[model samples]
Target: MILIRARVEAVLEPGRRTEVRVPVLLIASDRRWLELLPSQRARLKGRFGTPRSADLLAAVVVVRGPPSVLGPPSPLQRAAETVRARLRRSVDRLPADQRGVLPGMVVGDTSRIDPDLAEVFRTAGLTHLLVVSGANLAIVIGAVLGLCRFAGLGRRRAPPVAVLAVLAFVVVARPEPSVLRATVMGLIGLLALFTGRRRQGLPALAAAVLLLVLIDPTLARSYGFALSVLATGGLLVLAPPWRERLRRRLPGPLADALAVAAAAQVAVAPVLVMLSGEVGVVSVAANLLAAPAVAPATLLGALGAVTALVSLTLARLVVWPAGLAVAWVVWIARTAARLPYATIPWKGGGLGAVALLAAAVVAVLILRSRRLRLVAVAAMAGVLIAVVGLRLLAPGWPPPGWALVACDVGQGDALALAAGPGRAVVVDTGPDPRLVEGCLERLAIRDVPLLVLTHPHADHVDGVAGVRSHRAVHAVLTTPRGPGREARFTSGLVVRQALTGQRWSVGDLTLSVLGPLSAGPRLAPGDDGTTVNDASVVLVARRPGFSALLAGDVEADAQRALAGSVPAVQVIKVPHHGSRSQDPAFLAAAHASVALISVGRDNDYGHPAPSTVDRLRSLGSRVHRTDQEGDVAVVRTTGGLSVVPRR
Candidate 1:
């Protein structure tokens, strides 16, 4: 039986806390068992303890449940907690530079790493530096082997010593599932070396993968697991052949470095492309610069970690070496990130990844031969270059015409109007910042002449981050203030009331705010109730022969209150994302030719109800749902109206 201990760190539910365990995992790597006892489960009803450092040392063991479960208190939980505490203490004693790299190098704990520093690493394409993986284990083993050889231990003894070192390192790092997997793979590789059976590396890797997947089928869904496995497999299968080929063509050191970088990149590229939809062109260059530093940083960081266990003074001295290595890595990242077009975005997922990988394999195979390899690689490279060039040079917006776009933002509202060249206006920001940013990029919108925030709901305001990215904001109009108005305003947006008689120009299109008719009394459903939806800013946009009405989430009451104040419109954004509480009279007054509804599929609220849709259809208005049609666009010309739905 594996014994574990941990302290409650965060209260996830009323009586359940997310705990960090000590001594990490004491069980077999593939062990499966229940974690909590019946008596302990019964006593979990009341608040157990405060989630503070002082209370963290009071650890508890979980005697029942699957070992793969994250954050729940268990035998493994105590071990994780203990490692975290020790690492924290180590970091606190180190210099700033070494402190930044310590946890990541030792245990893949990057939660304490600053976001700015993380971004720097990302830009440099050295993100693997923050993760504890086979690469890290390899570096450790390589260093150990080098040390043993220097001390006069022959090559045969090197493998055993390396394996022993890996086992000890795993204990210090805490035997999390990921750490265990890495250790197992490292040990297998070292054993292969000792036995002169290096060809068994692939089978060993496959076995480790199968074992881990069987123990926790859910790990199959983990991106980290996929990345780790692919990277290791790449090193085994591709690295050796690449190294030999490069060695024949170039100097020994350069060939070896290039081979390592190329093999890992080729293996992991498809997975990275599939997940991020972007390829880092500078990854090879970044790795070549950062790879040499990894061993020193890891060894010194580990030394600092051990030294911290005994004397703070000793740990501080060790930190200097680690910090210097980390600084070099940071420099590499910053330089790589700043290179023009370092990352190229592409459409991603299984098909795209497979296609790229197939092309890469064909190119590599062709290159292996003396005759046809060069031609094949050149042809493939040309095809990729042409495709990328065409996409970059393609004209994004409709040619010299006015258009209104209702961006598909899941269950929130965001609309854009392209009036003329390089000019547009944005209506309500959506619920997701990333989605909204993507929409802006697709539309090729750079400047906002005016930004209209209809109301203060999270759906309408969450994309404020995206909006703020624009260089300039000429004006921002919002609904009249009430209880939560101040809190809802986007950080830098200048908020104003949509009073009667306010006019704004967005390129060739002119806009006017029509109603609320009067400032209604602050809504109060009950003593405990706060309703922000009752107040919405309504506006009308008109250009030459086209017109549209943007009605924020104003319900039936607000609509009735405005009555005849609203004008007829060619297009109408259905209020509250087609919620059932829409006012029929408001729809009748608008007399819209097309009604746009923004909502999500299978949303709990059952939005765009049949009744509301039928009402718009009865009024002879073509109904379009963003959820169904994706991004919906309407182009208005003197001839008539044309609609575009994303394919």
Candidate 2:
């Protein structure tokens, strides 16, 4: 029954397009097991359905509890809801820094996790503490065992008590995928302990993984699932040998902690690098300091939270201890985050990650002997130093020379023009700060003489923070017009708008706004109590023989209005990410040598419509999209134009 329950819980349903009407069969069996069979897997589509289209035709079967309960808010749902509510309340009382750690520690609720903090945790190499995995369970079991021994509990009775404790912990944590995965791993660890077979850990971990994947084939695509499995496997396979080696040089306890941290990091680093495109050089050092605090903090926090729920007065007494633990974690995160270059950005994808992992494996194999280990370590350090040295001594940006870059910012538009040397003029700040920052970093853009915001849309203005953070802006230019169709600068960058419309020189480039003409109508603040796309600020930049126009999110009406008034442009940043709202006359009049589109991948709005691309192509304009080429750059040359892609 337990095995069947585990299989059923692990199963992922096939995808369904809609809530199709299908017959469901319920089979009742002894030992209180109920099986649900869907008549047609094709008819069961929804958020809970499988993620793959091919899987939709597969059988949809679920086995849980008894036949009496087979509907919405299944047993798992009911339990998760109760746990989530309690977690929400507990987190609400914690400081912002500590709030995110709770869900991760208790049940792996990453929904509220902060990206920056998560990065720090990863860099500091303490990410395992955030997940309720085998390590967490081991800590709990070990503590319980120690307590039992102190209380004079019999060894035989202790196992039963530990099992019961495990069950209670699972219930409180809720049966999420991570919790279930951890529980299975924990149970196996306990079984190994009881049988006095330490070597059983690897086999148990592998078996658990196979069982999980077999039950839910969809987990193959889940990064979290892969990371959890790999981290656990790494610990099981590498920690022992690593610990043994470390014990020879350091105190037993310190060596054990360092080995555990190193093993998990070695196992998960490839995946983390692939997903994040950055490596934490300081992760090992950070985790060394943080390791001792995680267990006590989590245990105390959990106990205090549970006690507070039961008795407010008693909860207050425990809060101090809990607070101290939380403070330690908070301190670790802040300190790690403050370190310069804590995370070194790297190029990532499947190939890079695989190569890195292969390298790690080779390095590990080479470490078997003391002499080779020292040599391997020295070689690795040398390689790192060489890479850093080359990067620092490199003549100019990887792909040197001037270029105009169109940043991928989803539905908004942002283009950067490098006049010559390190001088540049920026037009539009993309909708997301992080995305824009990534684009700038790729281009090695440092200083901006003019920061032109095409008009304020959250998409265009949100990336202003990124600009302010990375580059020195002498002046900003915007169409005298305020936010066109939506609330402007809500993401905390609006305060920097004071320099709008002020012209600034950056070495040799000049930037200025062309429209949002003071005489134009107040852009018909739409029925939604805001202006529409027609009011976007349009920018025109000129430098020697090079010229470009940055059309914000302006629609056809504004495009037509501007076409009759503005001067010819050599390059055009297609308005509204090549939305169909563009005026044909405007495209023809601009006669741009190049057209740039800033759009995100798989965006729902279907930007850069076929017709718009065709129109620009028909006019002898070369069109480039950020989605395909990453940051697109156009540099002015005495003879003509030079193009570069961040990719």
Candidate 3:
């Protein structure tokens, strides 16, 4: 599915026909929009509904049958569309991740980016690299101005050439709100720099903001708009002073880069803290590491886009250098994201923003003295070393001899069954890739002999990418009743159907597919949540002096069916997050010593029902809930078995 912005021409309201002028979001399955320009008119037959977020859009039109083309787009728009298509085709030879990022960095086209890779970029606070931000426009304008200077052109002549470059970039990148905002901010900064009149920059920025908000009032509420303005303000106001200070000790180029990155990060910290509830500890460093490559990648990608209009072969050659630069950026983001405590979780909302702002003010006051600045730097370094040291020395987490871990993925299931060093059998990746991936990272599991997806529900399998990211999986075993939509994440892997009585082993650990006795019964062609729940693939995992029942989400009916065959074990992953629809006979049959429940805190579904918890306790089981304990691990003890809670 693709989403496009469209204007509403008419409305049919019961007996009245009304003509209206309003902007709306259009959801369509048609590929025609790829060829159509930004403002082209089209006749669409669809049902209108209230938009989820009505901040920018009046309504959402979901295209039902087909879209009717009213007319062709303008000549310029057609050329731009052609250039975009050609550019995409030219980069076909690059690696999948690089190919996706190049277009995004150039023209804000991100349809091809891997979701897992996008998550990594987000975690590292490098998402700006994948968008048409002020940095991109700054690079383009800076390059153009440098060329004019290199040719010995006068400053007066350089502005006109730079203005042309800005216009062309806006057209090629499509005059979306973000692109327009970046263009305006970039031009203001250019004007300030070229004229050597830094004081006028603020008034120009204020006028630009007033004009833009008046033109499109919705931009006032947009986070992107706010960030663009703040970043530009920081560059004009804070960067110059900081750059001068840094140049006293550092080289000119390094000082400039550090000042820009630090100013932008400082300006946007409050907003980011409130929005994401986390502070990116490594963001400034990540941006600094990525800054050198941004200019080359953006310039080359744009050049490639233009060259594609003339010759696809030449465009491919031009894009190769851009690909290498993008690869470096990708590496930086991935590496930074993997670092310990890359982001520090904090309070969210207005309170968090206010608290962070206050802290920043205090920090700035303290760092004004040279001696204090040195002290602060040393303190921060010491803290970082301490964190790394503790992480390496900490023996409390992923406790030794741990055989099974129910990761706290929130309202979903993800379990790592240890096979050997850095190897495990991952089952039921949770609803998010980041949460599950973080759990695996903490456990230091990099190689997976088998990935068992109990069912095709999103909660059971949406995190498949996290399991495969920076790791190797020999095979994937899933239930036979897999739907095409949820199974797409496992596309490149060897996926096979898990059958009853099927057995597999890796190292000393062994697994047997127990239940999922039958396929989902035939029903109407809609989401049959119950039927899917019943078809969850149940497993019995065993090792020396340890065993577990990794019951996916099978409810009452399937639980009753498996009761006769399912044997008692040391631990059991309570079915369906311990919902009330459990079979007492099945619970009695297991008689597990420890029961693990994976559910989210304050979830709307009220999972791990009170009655279910009581029933498990009555069955002579000690319950360990992930929502309470963070990550519940069943480790082997010298005498018998014990539960470890990494809270």
Clashes of each: 18, 9, 0
- Estimate, for each residue in 1-647, the C-alpha lDDT of model 3 and write its tens digit: 45677789887777998899998887654466555676577776666766645267778776643566778888888777787788899899999989999999998888788756886797798988788877788788878888999999987789888988898778878876667777776677667767876637678778778878898998988777887788778888999999999999999999999999999889888888876667898999999999899889989999999899889999999999999999999999999998877888767768999999998987988777888888888998999899889888877688999989999887789999999999999999998787899899999999999999987766778889988899998899987666534567888888888888999989988999886885555322243456668778899999999999989999998898899998989898999998888999998898798999998754534477889999999888998888666788888989999888774
**What residue runs in model 3 are displaced by over 4 Å at the alpha carbon?**
1-6, 11-18, 25-37, 40-54, 60-74, 95-97, 145-161, 186-199, 369-386, 395-647
* Cα-based TM-score, every candidate: 0.56, 0.59, 0.66
Off by over 4 Å in 2: 1-94, 110-114, 144-168, 171-177, 191-199, 345-347, 361-647
Query: In angstroms, how far off is 250's CA in candidate 2?
Result: 0.9
Question: Which candidate leads in TM-score?
Answer: 3
Better of 2 and 3 by lDDT: 3
Candidate order by lDDT, decreasing, is 3, 1, 2
Give the range where candidate 2 is weakest over 10 consecutive residues by summed lDDT: 38-47
Q: What is the lDDT of candidate 1?
A: 0.70
> lDDT, candidate 3, residue 610?
82
RMSD of each: 11.6, 11.6, 8.0
Candidate 1 TM-score over all chains jointly: 0.56
